[model samples]
Target: MVEAATIGYTSFPGYPEPPYALVYARPDRADTAIGNFLHGLDLADYHVALERMHIGARVSAVFAAERSALVTDFHWVLDD
Candidate 1:
């Protein structure tokens, strides 16, 4: 499953809520494999991925756990 989250948001004229970002976790969390997969990804990549799914999402930030593979957080926003 995809772990989607957001801390703050901004509303648009025709939108229902605020804008946010997205996180792609793997093996149930944001582990080394997941981090590695997203390591080289840029803002464009993130936007493209979200857009392909028809989501008006923007990645605010990506938090990774360097010491613990079991600890990770993904910040994102959704259109609906």
Candidate 2:
């Protein structure tokens, strides 16, 4: 499982800017393994929600089907 942390906005240039959350392989790890791109109708509210998320929260990543293997989805790990 990956530990999630809200890392703020991405550097990619765009109009409706996208925010990001960093995912760590472990809670004690300092380096980020990957960044999850967040999208919403209102970026401001989305960012606020992201900031409120507790650090080290459990999150899951979904990858695209294409060869690029880019992350296409992200969400909190849910119990069955």
Candidate 3:
């Protein structure tokens, strides 16, 4: 499975001028999987995308990928 998200800013304390971010999550990062899918993307691309959205990156975006967790804190919600 895959999940992608992008978020914009708010005026809460400690938040930056325009807090923005983009993230991609997948169950696999193999060479022929999500890793290849995300290949060639870089920091500049992130900055450019944010700029196009007028998000103004006073706070930085986090671009990363890792294996999915075996357990989640919200498991209880699914138990019913």
Candidate closest to the true structure, highest TM-score: 2
Q: Candidate 1 vs. truth: CA RMSD?
A: 10.7
Better of 1 and 3 by TM-score: 3
Residue range 1-80, candidate 3, lDDT tens digits: 22443444556564334443433333333332121122212224656653433322122222345435432211110000
Model 3 spans > 4 angstroms off: 27-80
| Tens digits of lDDT, candidate 1, 22-48 | 344333334532221122222345456
Cα lDDT of candidate 2 equals 0.44
Clashes of each: 5, 0, 0
Least accurate stretch of 10 residues (summed lDDT) in model 1?
33-42
Q: Where is the poorest 10-residue window by lDDT in model 3?
A: 71-80
Q: Is candidate 1 or candidate 2 better by TM-score?
A: 2
TM-score of each: 0.23, 0.40, 0.25
lDDT of each residue in 1-80, candidate 2, tens digit only: 34455555657653224455444433234455555443332335755665544454444444444544334434333111
